[model samples]
Target: MAGGDPHALLAAAADQMGKPPEGTPRRPRVGVDLGTASCVLVVLDSSDEGDCPVWVESAGSGALQDGVVVDFARAVATVRALRDRAVDALGTELSTAATAYPPCIPVADARACTYVCETAGFEDVTLVDEVTAAQRTLEITDGVVVDVGGGSTGVGVFRDGRLERLDDRPGGGHHLDLVLAGALGVETGEAERFKRERPTDALPILTPGLHRIAESIRAMTRGTDADLPLHLAGGALMIPRAGDVLAQYLQRTVVTHPHALLITPLGIARSAP
Candidate 1:
């Protein structure tokens, strides 16, 4: 990775989401994210300039729950499909990759993420907590990184580029979808689609759920400096005006990046050894 604007890197990653970039990959760096509501795979090629994204792919499959691999076969199948597509596009076999688990999941659950990657065909896999992975991309030296994924929110406090405190609790996008579902008298899937497509309307309905997440952040970062800005990572809080809701509720600075969903997956690629 190079010392450039992290947002630029995210924009680059976003542009290559579905389309494979031109040129053959060299020294490929790979990252797999087994998210609660989706699975994402990123491949980067290292050069003197920096790590450039080559291929990025994702699958909308709910194979995990709360950082645990609930459906082992489905998880493996999803990762394998992603891996196979990357191989087809890049014309190279990705033998090793890094992956992440939500912070504070049971050790066995975390290991299950690695196993899923291995079973999906990676010969070697590295495991990282989701918050640390997000830091790899944001490169925040002295602040907080909060990863609001599908199943849970993980908070990490950093000082001088070193992590000081880390914690996680269950409550995230899925819960918000549930709230929307109940309010609209619709099914979970419709609620999710509405939340994505009609976020403006959804924000009002989702405020309380966002507040609950804010309260979780408040409790988790209790001893840390309250002045450090809260950086929002992951896809859950990518909804428009979501950061404003959090900032108003927490009375603290909340920084939300564009293409926020790519934060962790991109960081995970940067983390690959």
Candidate 2:
């Protein structure tokens, strides 16, 4: 198991993006995240200390919507390209992988993620809900795990290292992009680029969208432990004050990990067999 402080694990994973670590990698595990905004592939090498990430890559290909495979061929192509690049960089063949989906989606839709990985050349594919995968990385024994992706927000409640509740709602970074586009009178694509390049300028415009996501979290986690801090995962709320807005709106403690975007992708890799 990758045992350590969750933030440290995330930072280590962030450090490994596109930069292979020293020495021969061992017990390589791969995770594929077919996000609405992009498809991310992560490969981790297992050791006595923990799982250290060796390779990380993302494609700007938008083939998924709300955690469902909307364009299977494009998703497959994107994953295959990531796999090829990782293979070339690591000098090893990755045969198995783990991927995730939103909790509210139908089972059939979740299976489509597996099919994409299989078609992308993985011999074995493991399927897990996006929230659970994030927990696998955060190891939140008694906190709420909120994964806000480009298309949806998935929530997981944990107690004593066990998941007590799991749910998701449709609203995330893509929704924020739409809001920003409307405010700036620009295309959604342009809004997305602006949000990424100039988040300081974009934060004020996206506050309502962030609040909507916070509302989704509040709704999904109504009955869970209210005292436990909300731990945010995924890339949607990585904007500077986004977490602050969530914390303020919800009136609950919010733990925003560094390299927030890679949390779920790294968790998916840890879930790989």
Candidate 3:
């Protein structure tokens, strides 16, 4: 957990190994998240001035797909543009940074996220898994960290500060979009906006989809820590009733945070060395 070289970083702390953070004001560590639907960069300040996490910026483009860098040029340009914006806003050249990937993404894909940062001109790079990163920020010790983002859901089981198991698979908000698309006979994009704008009205319609995600979690962690608390992280579950749907299905306590979408990205920044 101390400042160490990149190789010294651990798998347990990978989620938050090198991303921006919350709570404590720490040195400005940058975190780049190459998400399926969006790419985000966050920087946290330790010694600067105010009590805050600095350098929170994100840009959405069809660059990365399902947590993989598809269009390399678009990914590079998106990250580069974000870096420039943060540099201009913070008045500091953010050369070194950390980034993260889905819990179950291959090591090569995880490294791809780190490369995205370095290609954008970061000198130092730390790699972390997305769910672990979320737990770092939430500090969930004996519980499940379920990250439902645009592309997938990552589940991490932790006890006594050690992650017991980690797994992830696709089927997130995007999947829900397909459901809505079929129901409403519209494009997935339109359903996404509909879910965001009218979630209260949309929850009933999306119940089956949300339950599907909940059931995925139930199947993955069926026997272990069945009673453990569930901390929700990511944007997909940000739907108003998603947590309750999970609670009803899982019969366990489910946690939701303000700005849940930033949970993993912010935790990734905290992973910085």
Candidate 4:
């Protein structure tokens, strides 16, 4: 497995969005991430070294909240839009895809994620846990994978390439936006834009929220091995020095990546068979 330069793979994936590299595998695997703040579609080359993303697209969506499908119709529409965008960019009909849900959600709720893909015109859909999908992208054999998305933080502990424990809680970028909105006296949408575009300016105001997330991580991993480094895989913690804040707060090793948000989505595509 390629271990020395994970960030390079992530950067390559980001750079290839909407324009896949030439000579990529003809039959690409697809992943649909129905997230709380956005829906992402990822296509990856189907080959021995297929982990790199070929095309990726995301659309802001309120269809899901905290990993649950809240607005079913909007969810389907968002996935359909993402699918169409990928098809247009890749020039191929994407009929099958893999999607994921937060760990420990009810089976029915998780099936709802698969149904979103099926409704969006996918003929074959595979459902995987979000954290495992992240591991597929990070390729971490023994560490904690913490997926901090827009609405939730999912923690998965793996030992020897096997998942040992999985848990999720209600807190993420959305909550941080709430904090920023309140602090800056701006609308939530404005807060989101500011959080992304002016993250450095917003980080000081958002530190408390980030610490809350760290506390959630500490709680989730209470009984797990403390020595395992925390590998972050989601957009919520992409701010500069956010990893340092987490490390300082938890006093544990924390690993982060560029385009952290795409980790789970790309892994979902890898989960496809």
Residue 130, model 3: lDDT of 89
CA RMSD of all predictions: 1.1, 1.5, 6.6, 2.0
- Better lDDT candidate (2, 4): 2
By lDDT, the candidates rank as: 1, 2, 4, 3
lDDT of 4 by residue, 1-273 (tens): 122356666777788776644654577889999988888888877656445567888888999988999999999999998888777666778898999999888999999999989999999999999999999888899999999988899999999999998999999999999999999999999999998899899999999999999999999999888899999999888899999999999999999887898889888988887
Structural similarity to truth (TM-score) of each candidate: 0.98, 0.96, 0.87, 0.94
Model 4 bad stretches (over 4 Å): 1-5, 20-25
Task: State how far residue 29 of model 3 sits from its true place (Å).
Answer: 0.7
Residue-wise C-alpha lDDT for candidate 2, range 1-273, written one tens digit per residue: 345777777887777777764645679999999999888999888877888788889998789987888899999999999999898888888899999989979989999999999999999999888899999888888999999999998888999999888999999989999999999999999998999999999999898888888888999989776799999899988888888998999999999888989989988998999
How do the residues 1-273 of candidate 1 rate in per-residue lDDT, one tens digit apiece?
Answer: 433679888988999998956866889999999998899999989777888888889998799998899999999999999999899888888999999999998899999999999999999999999999999999999999999999999999999999999999999989999999999999999999998899899999999999999999999999777799999999999899999999999999999999999999999998897
Best-matching candidate per TM-score: 1
Better of 3 and 4 by TM-score: 4
Supply every candidate's count of residue pairs whose N, Cα or C atoms clash at under 3 angstroms: 0, 0, 19, 0
Best by lDDT: 1
- Lowest lDDT sum, 10 consecutive residues, model 1, at 1-10
**Which tens-of-lDDT digit does each residue in 126-152 have in candidate 3?**
888989888877777789999987788
Q: Quickly count the clashes in candidate 3.
A: 19
lDDT of each: 0.93, 0.89, 0.77, 0.88
lDDT-better candidate, 2 vs 3:
2
Ranking by TM-score: 1, 2, 4, 3
